[model samples]
Target chain A: MTINPYHDKRLQWVAYAIFFALLALVPILLDDAFLLNQLSTFGVYGILALSLSLCWGFGGILNLGQGIAFGLGAYGMAMTMQMQSQDIDTNPIPPFMLNNALESLPMIWEPFWNTGTGIFLAVAIPTLYCLIFGALMFQARVSGPFFAIMTLAMLSAFYTVFIDLQPYTNGVNGISPPMPLEVGSLVVDPYSTTSYWIVYAVLLLSTVVAKLLTQSKFGLIVRAQNNDPERVRFLGYNVAVYETLIYAISGCMAALAGMCFTFLTQYVSPSQFDVGFSISIVIWAAIGGRGSLLWAIMGAFIVQGAQSYLGDEFLNTWILILGFFFILVVRFLPGGLAGLVELILGKLPNMSKQQKSPGEKPVDKASLKEA
Target chain B: MAGVLEIQNLQKNFDAVKVINDFSMDVIELTLCCLVGPNGAGKTTTMDLITGRQKPTSGSVTFRGHVITGENEQMIARRGLGRKFQIPAVFRELTVRQNLEVAYSHEVNALKNIFSFSSRQCDARIDEVAEQVGLQERLAVIAGTLSHGETQWLEIGMVLMQDPALLLLDEPVAGMTEQEIEKTADILNTMKKTKTLIVVEHDMGFVREIADIVTVMHMGSLLAQGTIQEIETNQQVRDVYLGTEDH
Candidate 1:
């Protein structure tokens, strides 16, 4: 029997609703401050995974320097909060500036003092960096594994720069506001319910935005490029522009997630831009299912939750266990958790058929079965 | 009829191996021209050069009396040059309707494309292209699930959606069944009224069926250009191309 395509679409939306509903229940069930903080981290990382899914999963551009965007966002917001804590009458200089024995406030740090400017810079900085980087790289036709390597190198460079600039950036220790986040008169504590709600709101909004983007014409074109970029070019789409735009969007989303992370954790650090963290972000997306944004986000939550559990009980062996699981998932369920669900539900077509891309020889079903 | 596409002395070399050597052709408006050549005769490369998929070492490609030589593939496509690859290059994961929808150029703005999608008018256009390609019933089917012949037709439909002035097809009916080939021929024949087509094919019979004029190439150079009968009767073409086919 032919499945109604609309029914499948409805079913997907239902899955999304259930996922969101479960996320909503997390706060209600966990009254503990530590658990709420942990849950907030999961929410933030979910957005990060979603960002990766948008770039690598759909656009076929692997950005291993995603943390650079995230770090920039966190720092942008952190600087604003730090400047906010400055006394207008007695002492204008922030604690970090005074600690560095700066005679005057740095002109470079002035713009981020405004809440609006800080938020704008948080999103704009990464978006602009990605646009410039993507324009140069894609124009040169540097993509796939080469792009990944370039991004990784750039991330390492960004980390070193952050570390070397100790006076300005606070070096390896990172930037943290001395006071709570203040919106006009209300003080938003990092561990408070209000802070948790802020992260949740952004997470929910990002999820919806991501869903809409992937369903749009632009998303289809990006996915099309992933399969055959030359074909997209022949179809009247500037593949480089599409790839660049998607990469930039991913960067912006990563920035937003980073801002959320800073709001929850009350800190920003150079360690976030490390190559290992970038790889971990990729793993979250890989584990969930890069093919779908929602799956990627869920994958982040699942992996992080597992990490917390493993870290609490078996700190040393958690890494080993996760590594084993990653290998199994990569080998057996290449599509990740979402793909496994898709398989069980018979949503996907024959594996061999789906694998048989243009110009590729189709695998023999008989041989596959026998093997 | 006026010439819609003119390729003059097009030369392309991959390192030392010359793919298209001083190849030239004038494709008249609203004509189905078949490009027939042996296995490494640079027929596809010629199409690539014209469509701007591959940059020529030395050549000039003029579309409607304007020099489009060395233009990017997307730029050439925007100039009304639509090309279908040797492999069925439809977005396999997308539905048949979506395949045509993406090919349609109603909303060219990438940013706007992200927000507001194609209008209801595009649906009607997609239906028309689907009908033309005989994939109307398979509109809901994913391109990946379609048979090889259907995938070929879906790609042809995608090209039609663009309403291109010049359509270059590379081995469109390569692995099609006889029925599918006849259907494709019918589709091409219908399109011939409004579009200029340069179809590269190995099947001489299919060429004879749809081609108004045929060009035969050998060793990256034009060997013959004439009617199907003229090509079959030409002694040089027979010796270089059809002569070896008996084996």
Candidate 2:
């Protein structure tokens, strides 16, 4: 069987190269630290959208409270950064802990004292949380909107638990580390060009790797599971396992983005646990065209950047503008930005790798009966 | 030798309605058995019970000497039982070849096959299955864009890819034209040497062409069972199932 035209590998790789090359040019052209930092944070948002697009779009597992995982990742990094600011020979206490009148660093906060383990845990905790949560949901046969609501419920749980844990979580103030993360001699200054490029480079790599994955044989089954899960199950696949596996991966990616957010922003706040943040991540995927990873990332950049830039205005018209785009996207652009691109590409001559045979009509019954 | 399939006094109830009642049947290897019954005759439900889609209220389903009753669909299928639904259940967004590739796999482990590409052996097998189902040319075509008849054939093709010993096909030719139906019949007839298939159909003409053994059900109970000629002439079967051959 010939490779389908939609998954033309060479074309896809070339597109990725072009997209990232253009994005990488941004840091070179400008030296403004504040602007660069904001753009890097937006890159983190793109990564979050990319994660959701994979799980919900290709993998067909919708998560409504993905922000909880992001919040966890942020905290994972924040914990380490906080410990970095501490003098272990002296007090070794975070500002949040000081405010709460804690005499000693809690036992649970010990691991975060090391920067390396903290980075690893930043991705790991959320990944494990999702692996466990998704396994439970899929095994119990909870899916569709029920799965969505269940995840939202989990997000509510995280919000409540984190906000109530005055000692560990700082009770809603979250953690703002006094200094940047220091791994030996290197300090990961949030506003530096190096940090901006790191975020940019990671997003680029993530997009390409995730794109390759969605095009692989595993991706084939993921799409199959998305389209007809029962059919996939009867064909000898553990449909729940597939969904759970991908959900964990999505969790890992979001957590990575959250880790990067800590590196870019120098802080983790309760706002990461906000339901609207998670919903916004979903919205970015929806508007960007959840079907295509690149488009979804673009959607995140466009919507999040616009909201950021325009939200600063006194009028606060950004929400209305975002609502309009959301309506336009959902009402007509069902495939999101990717669908629009495909529609245009399908119209252009020589756009597709394979051309239809001349006068070869679809093999409908009428034609076969006529024959 | 053990039969390919054994359903011992299987019963399924949805709430208060007994969908399948005390139904028992044994299928030998390589038999193209047709289950013909009217609408809501429990033909589909029996398939469901055998494939682990529905949990039987009582009794057991054994396949190839293994007790598969109450096992999940994934596990049952892994035990070499493949199935097709009444409506074509192929992955719509994927190409015909991709759908076949998914079913043709022996790699059931998700992590093992994540980075794996289509092997030469896998591609050759997919091509062979595509040709068998008259979809060799349409392998690259998106399943969603395929015609109704083509989709049915695609589902059958998917089942064949698993290379299962027994296949449960529910109304395999429900929405096909005469020529398409004939083509489908040819495909099923060709698989009789290595595969055991239990097809549920309403069309007498299609059943007459493909069935080696016919089991007739009426209102969730077995009405009659015999060869085509014996079943066609059976007065009881005629009264409930063959009463109107035009179906």
Candidate 3:
């Protein structure tokens, strides 16, 4: 058996176990209901960031429309919850329908009322969208800048469609939960801390699954495809199929995260799935390092945690700071925090000796070229 | 058992320039045919046409007595035709073993590939090919980190894993140390026992070492076809190759 040092399955499982344990203890350590709620939201964002990493990092696809998939999932769950709350016999519609002069709920929104159907739609819709989009783009061999532009176009189009479909989607005002969910005499409030922790637990499990997928044989293909897709194709593998699979998987993951987000916020609005959210997910993946799933989740938690703790004071400057950070990290720290950690660990012995040297000569350009 | 490759009136044109004008060749089973030509001779394009990478203007590429002219690359590959690009085209991010495993993945069956059982036989074959290519020691090393010579070997190893009846290698040893080139020649010689090998290479010394027959191409047409010494002495072949005395 050939021993591969780069990917160790046992080490990965151990790491995931540690992560799960730590997340399970968050409610215990924090103890504050509001902080726990924020943590739950952070968990949702972490899942989104991890999904973005899987697509962009491993698959070499720049998905600028991830928020669109998330919105689909969130709205799917929200619409179903809203319809169930209304308790209308034939066509269960929200009160907003009467105000808009609509007599009954649309036929399309009926499937979402059932929990199984809602969850299925939450995964299926985004996956189907990505499958169609990926097939078209990959078959056309649209990559790099063209791929980015195409995804951005899709994001804007989805945003417009969501904002325009007022009768079904409620437009920009979005949809909110009418009441707490009652599952066979069990009442579960979305706003409750216990409910938030449940969402957090789901996030942790999803992240673990994502991490495992990355380390599998399928994951290796994805990583290799990103580095040199032509080579993968020449190896008798279908490069387009690999890309499409990852794209759909990433879309499903984003949708799952959005489902959690609906529970945390109890609302699904157009603004939540706008370009801002899409770009923010990219930022999280970038700060975490594109290669590692753990780093991406950490990047999400740190960035969101800082934003939440800093409050409204830093809200105005957050975008600017994030933009600058993106530029700085891409320029100086190519691997983000993960790369920095590796560098620091590498120089542990020389750190004390080189403490006095403030600035050294720049790294050799030729060596960088070789890498 | 039959004609491994039969190209009948293969025609290809790039806009106005007519490259590969009515080119044809017949390669029998288990024969090592070396394709030698100067730059722009369309040797690579010939392999591309055979492997279904590029559609010919007018031609028929029959592999194992079956027409595969317009079949997709993956489909052609699954039909026991493996190709190596001019550049070493191995998955750089993956280890040598992982690269071979992916190359040896199950055939493209729409439904079977979705829910296929892992093939232990394929794993054994990968190990066998790794040993053949002298990459057994470097099986765990990332292909991107390998030396240029090792990368070429890794590419050849990937092709070997496909278990193809006919192998098309393009510039298999373009940039290699003398020892590495010699090793590649030895591997090719060993490979010719079971597979029909068509090598497009410029290294005449290496070509002379393993090729059973030499086919000299000039400006996208066959200049000469014979044994190594026969082509080496042919006046027309000399004129096309600039009469390089190294061979």
Provide the TM-score of chain B versus the true chain B for each model in turn.
0.97, 0.97, 0.95
Worst 10 residues of 2 chain B by lDDT: B238-247
lDDT at residue A27 of model 3 (Cα atoms): 70
What TM-score against the true fold does each predicted structure earn? 0.92, 0.94, 0.92
Candidate number of the best DockQ: 2
Model 1 misplaced stretches (Cα beyond 4 Å)? A1-11, A28-30, A347-371, B15-17
For residues A1-371, write the lDDT of model 2, one tens digit per residue: 46744556665566567678778889899889999888999899999999999999888788999998899999999898888778898868877788888888898889887888888888899999999999899988888999999999999888888988888889877788878777778777888888887788778777866887787778888888888788888888888888898899888888889988987878787789888889889899999888878778888998878777777882567777777888898899988877776665556575343332111112211233564
Candidate 3: which pairs clash? none
Interface RMSD of 3: 3.4
Please give the lDDT score for candidate 2: 0.84
Top candidate when judged by TM-score against the true structure: 2
Which candidate gets the maximum lDDT versus the true structure? 2
Candidate 1 vs candidate 2: which has greater DockQ?
2
- lDDT string for model 2 (B223-242, tens) is 99989999999998888767
Ranking by DockQ: 2, 1, 3
